[model samples]
Target: MPAPHSRSASTSVLASGSQVQPIQTPNVPLDRSLLLMSLAEEFFDAAHSIAPSVTLSRTGENVEVYEKLISTGLACLDTALSHVRLAPRVEANIRLRYAGVLYEETENFMEAEIALSKGIALCDRNHYYDLKYAMQLLLAQFMFKKSPKASLKALDSYISNAEAYQHISWVYALRFERAAHSLESSSLTDYHAALQNLRSIAKLAGEQNDRPIYMMASLMEAMAHLKSTGPESMEHAQRAIAAVWAYQLDSDNRIPQLLGLAHILDVACSLRQGNPTVMINKLKLMQTMMDEALRDPTWSTTSNVIAIPINRAQNSSQVVSPDTRTVLGIGNDGRDNLMLSFVSKKDAFSITYLLCGMVFLHRNSTSDQKGFKYLETGLNSLEADMRAPRASSGVLPDCIATLQWRGQIMCYLNCYMAFCAAAITDWATAKGHIEKVETTARDFDVPLVGPLGSVLVYLTGVYYQGIGDLDTALEIFQGKTFELPAETGKTNMMNSADQVERDIALLAALNSLWILQDGDRKNPSRNTTLIARLEPLCKSHPNKDIETAFNLVMATVETHPAAALFQVKNCLRAALNGAQTTANTQFLCITLSVMCNRFFSNVVGAQAEKSAQAASVQAQKSGNILWRSVADGMLAQCYEVNGKAADAKFTRDHAFKLAQMALPDI
Candidate 1:
């Protein structure tokens, strides 16, 4: 199975409910000034008090309350600003507050931007430098998800303004935003520059005793390291874990959103280390922490912004409806209710479940049921989040952002589900899941590029191969039929995308080789030619699992009986080593079956029987119907050779039943 790589999306700042509508100059009674200001302040306070509820609300009721309060506040603030003889700074502050509310609570981005620009104008006229820079920062943050280039431009402008005013904190904040935007670009130079900026911020913040800024910078630094791939990757992951631990230890100042994000990074780092057991345990602990946080009333009240680093799909044109019943066959139907029961709150921690499922699939497990359950839960939670009232097409930035993140996740889950289904020889379900993946990528306009496209193409080949269409499967594996762009230019030796592309190509080539060797037994030179081509590529791409597979294929072509037996044993050792290191059950089963067949052909009944039994046990553990049937069939033949007639008949019948289950037409 192709491993999914984690990528970060453009940083997006959540809106703070403090912005309002533009104020018009109008005549009003003198006595009404203080009264209107007081009323506006009261409404603003009311809205701020419930703002956290709006953030976490599953239903629209809390949102309705926050919107009503902010709407009323905007009206009062507008009345006061129109006629009152208020100080310029005071009026500017009110406008900033109104704009925040409009942008955050109501999602009225146009009104919020207009009010913010007006507020900045007022601050400029009065020389209110602090308020002016603050509003500018807010405006830049607001533009990040909608227009990253525009956001960076705004940040550059504000950084200069802050430096001119000698506001060190504002300057640091503006520079941090600029660095974050730089990290979004797919340029090595930009990445290095972003890292440098973060390092500088961390150093200056620590020297100035700004612990919060220092911690944030440290976290960002860790994230940058996590995204990178090289000999230093594990070192960086360890550093990330250490940074997260330090942040967690600050008991006096715990921000739930930050803490949650930090904990996720911790889990991701653990995953990168390749210790499945430790990673799973950490995921469980993180889930407990999330549960505790959700139960705390204070968790929802903080106004701190949360910018998740999930990768979003490209070119999302419309909001996909949350009703997944038709697409996923999940609903009030009892058949899938057990799967849906695992669904939890759709938040940062929900991603842990998806990670856990991936881990389970990667490990050498007997059954994929546990992994399937975790993936189902994660998918359901994402669907539930997408179904939230705020995830509508009219919300623009929020809607598109939500679609991108969730849609990308959905694609991964669906692809993995297809793999699991194929393992069990559940062809219909496997095809359905693959179709779902394709539809999702198309619906969300997710570009099928790099590793994602590779995975999809590989799985399509698997689907065809499983259904007995060897010709089509061979075409797909050879990349002769898929419409995806060919890998071009010099490959980055350390780049994960390059690595995955190579891995997929190698796997496809291996599969194609297998088909040709089986289909054209008389054409020995063709197999030799293919092996010559694959040997160096395998040497270049040095994956343990792929190497094990390549060795097994090599063993098949040895013409001499003695050489073939020796080579098969050597390949078995390699397969066993791969099983221990990579936990690839499929490789072990294939290798053992080949060894059994070699022994049987060489007239070694007892050795063949032993190998067949071992193969059968592994096949059963892997939950792969095709492998299980093959192993059982081999075992039955071994029994017949041993003169155990009753055992042979019973085993043969069972093997036939399993073969029918795997392929009904056969």
Candidate 2:
């Protein structure tokens, strides 16, 4: 008899090298079962090449060809497991393969794991690399969603096997092909390196004609790279953008959204590089691409836009309808707010983006009349959009999310304006803006706001402190806050990750001083625990944000004038070393200025020593005079207060000179 044709076979299923008839299971086993087995196994070899055909015997009705094909494959396992100890190698492998699928379908994880493992072990132990790769492929998929840790460990075990086996050629795929799962594991720390590996995989995939796998690999690699901003990060971002351009896609491929994000990175990088042309182009590209995406049918719904609340309204029409103005009974664009009586106009994403953009725009564009007007118009549009209905008819598109949280973005934008206003001593405006910010913050699951919320919570303490409400402010400064945890898998290595508990504790402590009665907020009456909680953090992580949190407690709560000055100087000096644009540095310096002028802050001798130390450190170059001047002035006051007549005159002269050099505006 000729050899049968087939490739895939399960434990009891036998695929052969040629098409053949399926043998019936006999109740009276008088015939040679092996002959029937050989015929039944041939279908798999050419399973993809030839169409399936069904045939009925005298005892049966004609079944569909596909159904007959699946049944034939499945029947191989039905009776083979009972006699696995007696079966030949090929028979056992076929039976084990089929049995694995059945066990998995029935949620018999242990049975499936054992059957697959045994088949794989046999192939692996015998240097059957191709079969081993196939087995690994099947096994990993099952484990990835369940025991990722175990799957990762097992994959490492098989890597050596892949390299040693002769049958698995270089052309054969890697048995340990789970780079993503590896990246998601605690074993694989470092987002930057993970990004490089993913990029390499995407590059390797580009050489292959496997459209689905290659494209998927490219997208996954792109997302992984973007999630972690690393060295030459823009290159990975550009690669992702280029991947999208490689294929002409008509629909929203998600690849274009990535491409748009690459544009944002390009814009920011260009802005930093002082190339306004490149920055403008990238910014325009981002806006254009985002606008295009807003019209995407598949992603046009709120669920899809919820992740990017600011992006949904990029394609929406006018913010204020002509009909809306008429219905409100207001004259054209008079004193009335544009959004006062308007219906829903935009989603959350749109509102968040416009507001944040307006912040930087305001700082950079007040000189341009047209640009200033555009900023106000943008703000009006945002408010109108925010008033839009969350859902329609209670039957939202499948793509729209039912719940959304964008408080961090809103808070940052609002607080940004408030902060700038406060820094410039425009207290009335700052106070009004912060009040709005407080309202917006109530909308989110607080700790989920990440670093942005942390900054806001910290700043709220400063605002109260700035208003001379020291006791109230001290409680805010000492409030407990949960540090938001990393959103990526716990395995991703990133410095300074915050946990929810930490942020909660930090915020809670800050809130305490503000919420407590006057007696509790005074320095002498303050809780001893605040210093205990803060002192350890300052000692353990001298350069971390925790240290700044500690400094905040001292600056607001401590009654010792000299100690508050010392704490502020310590924070400012540390800021000189840390290369980050955190609000910590600004808060530290500003609070220092306010502290130095306080009646209780009269310790002159120590102030002079610390101020002299701060001026010499070039690292705290904030491009502002506030830091150095405050330090210099404190030094001058220290000499005067201690009655060092000559030193006081010299210090005062140096303070003026340094203040002039540090800030032209001041």
Q: Which whole-number lDDT from 0 to 100 does residue 199 have in model 2?
A: 57
Question: lDDT (CA) for every model shown?
Answer: 0.65, 0.44
Which portions of model 1 show Cα errors greater than 4 Å? Answer: 1-126, 135-168, 208-212, 270-273, 298-304, 307-345, 364-368, 385-395, 441-450, 480-502, 521-537, 540-544, 557-571, 599-602
Compute each candidate's TM-score over C-alphas.
0.71, 0.40
Judged by whole-model lDDT over C-alpha atoms, candidate 2 comes out at 0.44
- Tens digits of per-residue lDDT for model 2, 225-245: 544434444466557656655
- The number of residue pairs in model 2 that clash at the backbone is 73
Scored against the true structure, residue 41 in model 1 reaches a CA lDDT of 66
Native-vs-model 1 lDDT? 0.65
The per-prediction tally of clashing pairs is: 13, 73
Span of 10 residues, lowest total lDDT, candidate 2 = 306-315
lDDT at position 635, candidate 1: 88
